[model samples]
Target: MKLRRRLGIEWTGVALAASLIVCGLIYWNSLSGFDNLLYDRLSEYDRPEAPDDVLIVAIDEDSLATFGQWPWSRSRHAALLNQLADAEPKAIAFDILLSEPGDSEEDMAMANAAAQTDNLLFPLHFVFPGTNGAAFDIKEPIASLKQAAAAIGHVNLLFDRDGVVRRTSLCFKDTANGTSNDEIVWPHLMEQVYRQINGESSAIFRRLGDCQQPLLMPYANRGDFAQVSYAAVANGEIPRAFLKDKTILVGATAQGLGDQHPVPLGDGGTMAGVEIMANLLNDITADRFVMPVSTTMQIALSLIPTWILLIGFWRWRPRTTIFVSVGLVIFILSASAILLSLQIWFAPGAALVGLALVYPVWGWRRLQATSDFMDGELKNYRTETPDIPVLQVPLGPVDLVTEQAEELAHAIKHVRDLRRFITDALTNLPDPMFITDLDGKVKFVNKLAQSGVEDGVQDLALDDMLERFVAPEGLEDVKDYLAIDQELREHDYVDFTSVKDEIFAMRRARILSDEGELRGHIHYLADITEVANAAQEREEVLQLLSHDMRSPQAAILALLDGQDATDENKRIESHARRTLALADNFVGLARIKSSEFSGEEILLSDLVIEANDSLWPLAKQRGIKSTVEDYTEGAFIIGEPSSLYRSFANLIDNAIKYSPDDSDIEIVLRSIDLDKQAFVSVTITDQGNGIAEDMLDQLFERFASNDDDSHGTVKGTGLGLNFVSAVMARHGGSIRAENVREGGARFTVLLPLAPEPEELV
Candidate 1:
């Protein structure tokens, strides 16, 4: 379908999606940078190394305090290695870079110990030129340590353009006398290490040339990882027995070691240098990596879902499509969150954004086109045109003159016939019709108007006619409307005074001559008596029914609760009373419909007092406190006395029924003046299970109740509040029900106070 023919909801969804896509594109680089930082940090903290079985023998603060700042004599390292060898660890790694020559004798001892153990792997470093025109080098102790360890590998770090460490280097380059160069990578480290440990090289690292580069690992905060103090390890506080058949990494964590790099790790600081190596080791061992889908694939995936949503919305109504689109968006977001939690990097913002933007625009254009087409078709029918062409006969000279005269006569007759037809149609219409000459003298009056006019006023001037029959206010409006028509050739329609209790609408349109001269005016009067009478009858019926039925129903309920009634009889009587109450509700609805109720000024405080007195017995029987607070004692409002009483009674009854046995139902009356109009407000708040947020909007609608299970249960007719709403509306007031933030539902009735005539003026 064309875009203009799509549903509004589809178009709206598309618009949202487009907006998101635009926003995402605008912030692409920033978002990508943030993602990279987040992943790098998470990976540094949570990457699985050699499992929990691995241990770190730290050279910590306590060790420094006991044995002085690190770079302890190689002989001390020899002793520590020897102690660990007894535990039979699977392998051992040196996170620290030992480069400078230590005591020759101690280095020899440590190297000898390493050779005998055959488990240690030493770290190598990659150096790069710095900004200050100087070369920085990472030195790993090679001379004395070369023959001791099974393998050595570089722990090179790579940072993004923004200087944020995101990727790690797994290889290093070595040149000898400008003659030969060798590249050593993670595969090389693993190959030598496995060969030495297992006594044979495994096929896993055999395809060195074809293997992918360093794996991408999930990142987390630095504190997310487990760390033990170097002091504990050096003092043998760590469970040495558990180190058996495990890998161990020994590294430095002192603050000034220059190993720290800015990463999205713990507390927005860089992860300790040792932690980065540990994570890389974990990535190598466990093979946990992210294989990012290509950019093209990402875009395609995003667009496909959006297109599907748009298609579905196009086939649905605007409102339904909107709901569905919203639901889809929510689902998409939720799914994205879940995927992220599971470490699956799917493009959420891109896909959902596209969907949101495209659908709405598509739907709106579609709906607009459809509406325009329909409107064009409707216009064709509203316009008037003759079905057939008129015939013209020609004649010569004298014959032509006579023929022309005869033709003119016929044309005049046709015009007269048309006028008579119009006049006759006007007379039969429900609206009163009148025609006047340019002098404002009455020329004709339709049947309805003639019947309504006084006996002597068969023909009269417009001004005299108005003065004799129209009210002064209505007369002034008519005169002004006529004056406007005279000056502008267009006049505003004015409402005429009600005739015989019927509302009348009047409008005067100018009748112009063919020469563009003002000829006369056509006055239209419509009798809206039926419409008014129907409204008034509805109100009266509602009031009468509410009043008549309540009396009997209340008496029956009182009899049911009387002391003379036995328990069984009371139960039976209660059921009967409830049935009677339903009937009373029906009657109230009828009275409300008939417009029988009228308003009067009554003190809000007095109304509350009377309501409390009447409902107190029932509330006490249920052991609920029915309290009333009248803060507007002198404040008066206009409403039918009986209608107001019944409305409050219904609210109190509802509160009593819903509230807990010992809970309190609070009733308050107060005066509020807004926009200089006084209103008396009655609030009935109940300590009941509050209405749900979703159901609150429909609370006051007729036959709408939260209680769905009405089988054999006391169910109200649902007309009590409906009647109350009707009564309030009649008195130019309103009632609203809402769930309180704290608890329970509160029903508020706001009634307008009858203003004095002078005040109205």
Candidate 2:
């Protein structure tokens, strides 16, 4: 589904880009304004060097001042041409048209002077909307001037749509379907001069397929061409040697004469008509005209980069695409400039338009697509998860992305609410708790957890936090337990007293992500101070009872033994022994339940021997033959000595009570392997009635006994087995009882072997 959505967005962008490229190619002329403007600006960097041979004889304000303007007589033009002809110039072109008859004497003088010159060219201009509805009416030099020594050519200028003269036609064909004599083709006046000088057409004219084809002319700098004042040349004030071997174009340059037109000089100024011809003649002579690219090439150049950027959108990020877009703009312009320097013109407007247009359009479309996808996903989430109601406001109408933004905002609000609820629950927890990351840096602490922390606890190291609150005596033990891998630690909780004398049971659990990856830990510090204090008081009371009550029981037994061997005395002695055993069991059970496990290295064989010896007197009275087989060969385990001694002693005493007279009670100690870890197992078996089948599951439970059908006169106190079970648990060990199949019940106890002192170090 995501793949399809992504493809859809890509296709939309491609289609938009293709449309822009097509429009650029189809309506290229409509967009040429920018290209022309750019061309005008770029042309300034490499303007053509004006040739020394082409010179303009300007009828400037000075000339008009001297020669008396306001339709200066034709005799003045005739005199100027005669002077130019005397200079031995290559050619002379008269820019002032003389189609209509002028004053008789001046006209005759101009005609006679033109007849004398060998290389004179006459101007022939056209007037639009001919009298007979022909395309245009040609105005030529008068009949006598035309029949003189040289050819006639048109002096019309070609302009672009924006009224700037940038191109010229070398020749114009007569296509009005007139008579053969009228169907003549005329070259530009500058072209005629070039032909007269070289005896051949200019290079641009020779290459034209048709006389009407326009040539893009590179202009010389304004006023750069050599010029002489008309009055100065006409009166021989300027030296003829300066005009020697030059093509002279004579025309008006004065502002009052109104002979100037706008050119692509980029200064928004005008050039005189004679100066325009001078530049054109220079372009023709040097063959330096700029040819525009073919239509197909222009379209290709414009579309290629636009499409490259369009494709780039799919691969690059928004930032990269933006840079690429700007780069494409620079590339297109640079290419245009380079080509222009090589005398080739390429229009960059359409290409630039495509690049500039497609970028933001595609960005908007992509953002809209992404917003839509997010909206759908968020809606799906709202439907699947438990509904969290949010108030809705009417927005009336909006864009899709804006609406999606609102939806996203609402979703974020709901998430914040849920987080706040969780935070409040944790803050109000009865017990203190803190959260830490995998690096053991505390990330969160509840109110209760902040009790002893002087400053903010966030991001504090776990060990540092523990050191701040945990009492000095238990800090090392807590740290050791926490240092062990959570999965490898045998115990679930560690007990520690805070600096404030409050006891706490700290349990750590993993905080996992939804995929069950461990992200951190949550340490819950349960306040067990009151429970611990009560347990301490109970143990003290039990200890006092054991010592105080055992003294009286022993005195009673001792008195009875000295006085008589009567039934009453024997019964009193039996009861007193049972009472003493009961008190010992109560005290041992209380101590095991309340106290923390602090172990030291002890030999398992020695403990077993000591337990057996402690109960030897009772076993001897019952005539039970107690035997110990030491197969373990001195295995050491870490355990509390007092608890372990009472546990083993109680096991042997139970065996003695259950066994018949003269039966053998065997205690075997052996080292064994359980789950790849070293352990010591103690098996005690008695030759007596086996345990009842119904009592096996609850054998280790408190107050559990098999005394319903007694095997001996002295019955068992149910708590003796319970206390032994508690002690075994504290030592990271286990005990189980089962029928031995031989006839009596067997008790197997397994305790993990402690590492050697050297190994621990």
Candidate 3:
């Protein structure tokens, strides 16, 4: 595939990958319905040997059948406890929260029986925090029953988002209103009962998310634990041998009387909440708790299906891609189920979603690429192949949905040639071209974008590619273009050197809709190394020839009579002198481009004086007075002495050349303060026609000038002010030219003040 098409595919693949990762992270927090279903299915395959330590004394329907009615009298519970106590059981835990007092005599009967063995445990229910009627009170067994109980722990269960009781809280807080009061914490019932049974204090707990700890309930199936009935115990109809040395959990399981929670193993079926706790306690006995797969690992593994399918679709045939994708998905599910059985869980559904989406998303991406390719093809063929052949899809059944697909296919066929042609064009192009969106993401690249990308590099930003290819000095302009920089956009064209020393002219234009809104930009890079090098060679030839001719021309000029020379002779001498000046300017250009100058602190006045002395003779011939203002001696700056003198001399020469004979030429030096920074300012103004409004902006650009023809100077070398600008840039100074109001052009130069040696010390 061509890179433009590849870019579309890459974008679609990345977007789909990002969405898959985000969803996997979300599932890690609160599992999706599909992920939850997978977990449920995996639970169905669990087959564990039954445990023997814990018993569930359920208040099932049979107990209700035998025990008269629901909410049996407290005396009846007392009778059950009394009978269980006689069996010398290790402990008895109540899942039901017996908060309010029953009949006095009945509560007394239950209390009296519970106080007998001191191995009784009951539940305490606290109001849910942030609820409308949130209560601060902790509901414990009635006073007499509380005294009889060995320990009381909260029976609050933590449910997941979909109302599945997946975890259990190790600790909870009592809140008066909707907020926690005093940050107090209370342990959960199972934990507290276990501590009491083992004679231990608090053990360390790790929380799952905010409050709950993951419950690795050793529960394999609903009937995994031994269950008896409340009525059987209450009536003493069961053998004590079955109950001896067992920890008993008591709660209602008769239809609506008990809390029924949907568990992973229950197959959409409900298990009694008390039986759930029984399994938890059984797991505690066996020291078996499930370890969840890490979220990072889950996220990474979730991308597997996308990677497999996307790579396969791009590299292989459709049938092979589907076969590989489907096979990988099956392998993932099977492995995940096995992991779940081993008490390690992974989200198989997340992988399934990623795999299932690759083909449709890839197809959609192809449709877009086809459309773009066709648009470009029409542009190329508007003068060559304007009449595009449109296929006429036959009118089939009157189903709009089916007809839409047929119409789409017919339309795509119309552009099928365009897609192939553009694909070939981009593939054959000698140079790499890239297109980017407003956000600087590369939307397209040619076949040669990165020929060596197979080894390592991928997902390179446009700037990164430029940095790799372009010279460091040119990288800034490349970045500015990438940023849609307004200043760079003002330039119609840019010429820069690549890191390989190749020359290229880059033309950037905004891609806009007919409505004149920005869509993005197209950057076309045209290599012009040979053309630019040939131009440079021509310039060097002119400079050398000019240098060679200047000596003979000067000899001829020097041989002229200064006082008795004819007007024609004077004019010839003048033209020859201009030629010599142009040659000298070329010499300066070659020198400046190749040399690096080091700076030392020097008085600006010295360079100024040297410049004035050098130009005084030229000024005298024109009868112009080159005046300097009286200034303090503190105008010190740091710069290369030669470059500084040359820069100032160029300014004075311009002033002398532009002004008429007998004109006053002036240079002023003073101190200025800005933003608490001290700077020395130099002002040079020529009493000539002030700078043109248009020329002021680009006055410092090489070969840029207001003078169209070479009028006074030799070919208007316009390299003068540009050299001055480069000098200032190197020295961390600034220069600006403005049209003076008094019929002259004013140039101001500012250099930051340097502290004296004494001050530095």
**385-489 in candidate 1: lDDT tens per residue?**
223233334434565335445555555555566566776777787767778897778888877767756564445888876665466667777677777735564
- Per-prediction tally of clashes: 58, 0, 0
Q: After superposition, how far is residue 513 of candidate 1 from its true place, in Å?
A: 35
Worst 10 residues of 2 by lDDT: 708-717
Total residue pair clashes for candidate 2: 0
TM-score of each: 0.39, 0.55, 0.47
Q: 467, model 3: CA deviation in Å?
A: 43
Selected candidate, larger lDDT, 1 vs 2 = 2
Give the alpha carbon lDDT tens digit for every residue of 363-429 in model 2. 6677766776787778886786554444544454677777778777766776777678788889999
10 residues in a row with least lDDT, candidate 1: 708-717
lDDT of 3 by residue, 1-761 (tens): 35465665666666666566547555666446777666766666664555686888999988888877778888888888889999988888988778987789998998999998678898888764435554545777788888888988887776666777665666675443235445556767777767777886333343235335555454657787788888777777889988998888898787777588877665567778887787666555555556567667877777766776665665788788767877987898888888877777787666676666666776666656655555554445434543544444575785644555555555567568667766667656787566667776667666665554454223456677677668999988766655566544656667789877988887776778755788876667778899998878866776666567677778877877465768888778777876766566556656666556678898898788788899898889879898877474657887888777878888888777777678887899988888998888989987876666767778888878544432232222277888788888777889988877777777898887777678774
Give the winner by TM-score: 2
Instruction: Give lDDT: candidate 2, residue 692.
Output: 73
Residue 250 miss distance in model 3 (angstroms) = 1.6
**Cα RMSDs, all models:** 35.6, 13.2, 18.0
